[model samples]
Every structure is written in structure tokens, then in C-alpha cells.
Target: MLAHRLACTDPPVNLLSRVQALMVDFFWDRMHWVPQSVLFLPKEEGGHGLVHLAGRGAAFRLRFVQRFLTGPADLVWRPVARALLEHCGGLGLAESLFLMDLKGLRLNNLSSFYGGLFNVWGLHRKERPECCGSLFWLLREPVVRVSRFVCGVGPSLQQRLCEERILTLGQVVEVCVGPVWTTLQAWPHV
Candidate 1:
């Protein structure tokens, strides 16, 4: 029941810890002789197969992200998800997920739920070395991701850059300063 609930919603950390303690206490006669980590290991590995709630929660969120990204475009939750993404990154969900400088994300009004989702997605992406360094990923990476002063670049600048279709580092290098200046006439420099 708890596992199923975790798939849909994240429980508070303290609550999860309490639940884990209770489970551990129930498993042991009186005292915990083994480390919690060992208990979380597989039974085949000489430890009881304990379900790590945090890891399970992350897996569930990652699964949801997978479905959101690859599922049919008409999914019911897409609009809500897209709105949240746009609010944070000023772009579509897919575009923001792939192109936004997530490291420098501002969570002023955003919920931590989505923040955790992004962290899980980032970790998942990093796990796949081929995807992290792939041509497609590189081409989709926002210029700010590689910027030295990433936090210094405000959302307005990032949005302006996106509006001008200067999304990636490759695009920034290829674009002519004249065109950018043409659109941003008030700006002294391109």
C-alpha cells in the first residue's frame, strides 16, 4: 500500500524515516545488528530485501517523467506539466527539459516535487554516458548550461535568447550579431 502510494505522491522525509524504523524494528527481535544499507540489499546478497522508500519514490517519479516525455502528446496531464515547465523555463516541457540550464533553475514559486523530478531526470541522463555526450544532447543544451556566471544570466535574457532561436551554444556561435541587434535594438551590445 505504501509503495503504491509512493508512486503517485511523495511522503514527508520524517514520515518515511519513521516508517522505515518501524519496519526495521518489526523485522529484528530486539536490536538492529545490521546496517540499514545492508538490509536494503537483496536477499540473495545475504541481506534482507528491504524497500528503500526514497529510492522507490525516485524510481516512480522517473517513470512518470518517461511517460510524460515519450507518451502520446495528448496525455491529460501534459497541459498542467507544460504550464509548470513554461513558468520555470519559459519554454515547452520537452524543450525546457532538454535545453534549460537546470543547474541554474529558479524555484521561486515552483514546487519541490518538480525539482525532485528534474534531479532524478538529471541523474538518469548522467547515468547514460552516451546520451550525456551525444550530438543530439549537445545540440539541445542551452548556452547558459556552460556559462561561467550561469546564475547571473537572468530569466529575461534567457527568454530573449530563446525567442531569437539562439538556444544552444552551437546556435549562439553560428548566429550573426546583426540579427540579434536588429531584434534587440534597445540593447547596447549583442
Candidate 2:
């Protein structure tokens, strides 16, 4: 209910922070010491992850733009959105909204709106790239960076891995568990 209201009106950053802070405080009071980074992790990674509310709200706003673009002609908002898009020309709904700078158009803050738009479009960008039957390609599919998979693994480790010609997660797994495992384990940071 609160989110729905927030979605309509451009809620302030302080309000969003307050809500997140309250959630954190509640968990802290219960003796749950989960890290913020861990909270953002996927469930498969063993964290009780929550979808970002701002992202969801941005998606909701974009849904309106989508409806305007693809929805039945009978709908009232569709015509308005279509007219706006036609008037703007070339620019996408998200871009048009930013360019117009309409005072009445309430997007739940700029960062959330942009983040949501990226989240929606980024998925499509990832899916379109064809993996050409390569094991390394498949391993690199989910994440473009190794640091995202393993928390606290810094740029130095990444550079070392690259220097050793170790690229994908599959390679990392093979090296860590294969005959080279002992040698890798004997390395300074391992």
C-alpha cells in the first residue's frame, strides 16, 4: 500500500532511506547481523534477498510507458503516451520523460527511475548476445565480472587471474579443484 502510494508520487530519498533504515533496525534488534551486500545477493547464493523497492517502482512506471506503446488503442492513457512519444520522436519513453522535464510527471526520484529502466533493458541486452557453444562463454554469461560472483575478491586477484590466463568461472573452478589446486592453495592469498 505504501509502495503503491510512493510509486504515484515522487517520494523523497530521505523517506526511502528511512524505510530501509527501519527494516535494518528491525533486523538488527532481532540479532540478525546480515551484511547489506549479502541482503542484495540472489537466494541461490544463500542470502534472503529482497528486490529493491525503487527498482520495482521504476518498473511500474515503465510499465505505463510500455502500455502506452503496446496497449490497446481504447485505453485513455495509451493515446496520451502515444501522442507524447510521437511528439518527442526518436527518444524512448524513458528518455522522453527525462528530456521533457514535465513538472507533473512524477517518477520516484531520478536514480530509481534510471536504475529501473536499466534493469529492464539490461536483461534484454544480455539475452540477445549469442553464446557460440563455448564453455568459457557460458561461464561468463551470468556475470561479466568475476568479483560479482565472489564477494571481497578484489581487482588484484582479478588481475592475477587474468595474468595466469584464467578467465571464466569454469576455469576458476577447474584450477581450484584440479591438479593445480595444491599450487593455487600454496599461493600467498589462497
Candidate 3:
């Protein structure tokens, strides 16, 4: 609302305050339960910051945010991609994969959940040798798995910790909501 007020009021200015307000709403508000530390700092500063696996339904939220946080989200993702690509330059695999951190995420907001997934998929797909294969399907594999556990949905108390390091906004979705997607797939992996 402050952004709208500043953007519309008086002389019609694009001041820093208004811009900042919009960015905050678009990014921070979207992520359901992340602290200020993850939201504000760059990935280099140590925060996965994406919304894949924070809670019961955060995957859905991250997925929504992944699609809609268009303007600023795109900008924020670019630098992270560049950094990842630069770091993985020597192996000569063309594409790089990152396993992000997922802790303290909320599940009520759809935008934050989906938004985080898109960021993860987008970042990994960058400069990859394979262009036609969208990272959406590739990342979906882990995300669907993690979401099941984090959401507390499809378990009778497993006696093991499955792929925990694969936690991210995407993996959270995998664990939390993997069951839902499995229904859609004829050969869904259990």
C-alpha cells in the first residue's frame, strides 16, 4: 500500500522509498516464514532464501511466487546464477546444480512457495548445455519427495532421513506435496 501511495501520490515520483516498498512486498512478503537474515542477504551472505521446504505447505507457496515474482525476482536470480556458473566453470559440464537450505519457511502464502521453486529451477537451468529440457521437470523430482515429509502428509513414521541436503524451496515442495503430483503421474515413484 505504501508503494501504491508513493507511486500514485502528488508529483508522481519513483523515489527510493516507493521502489523499496514494492520490492519488499514483492519479495519478502511473498516468502511465508523466512527471517530478515535470509530475505535481505544475497546467497553469498549465507541463506538459501528460497521457499521450497520450510513447512507443511511452503512448496505450494514457493511455486506460486516462482511464477509471479517476475520483475525483481528475475533480477535477483541473475547474479546468483552468474556466481554459480562462474564457480562451476572448471568441470566443463555446462550446467551446475545447487542444493539450497530450507528452514523456517511458512506455508499459507502461495506466491512465496511457488516463487521460490521457479528461482531454483531458473538458477540451475542457466547456461546449461541442455536448453530444451526445462529445469522445471528436473528439479521437480527432488521437490516432490521432500514436500511429502515436511508437510507431514504421506508417512507412518519412516525410520530414516531421506535426502535432507536436497532441501530447498523446490525439495520442500517435493517432500510436502509429492503425493499430489504422484497422482498425476502414471509412474510416480514412492
Taking all chains together, each candidate's TM-score versus the true structure is 0.62, 0.39, 0.20
Clashes (candidate 2): 0
Top model number, TM-score: 1
Find the candidate with the highest lDDT and give its number. 1
lDDT of 1 by residue, 15-61 (tens): 98888878888777557787778888899998899887888999988
* TM-score of structure candidate 3: 0.20
Q: Write the per-residue lDDT of candidate 3 for residues 17-39, one digit (tens) a residue.
A: 46546655676666657675576
**Model 2 bad stretches (over 4 Å):** 30-32, 37-51, 82-190
TM-score comparison, 1 vs 2, better candidate: 1
Worst 10 residues of 1 by lDDT: 125-134
Worst 10 residues of 3 by lDDT: 89-98
Q: Runs in model 3 with CA error above 4 Å?
A: 1-74, 77-132, 135-137, 143-153, 156-163, 167-190
Candidate 1: deviation at residue 109, Å? Answer: 3.4
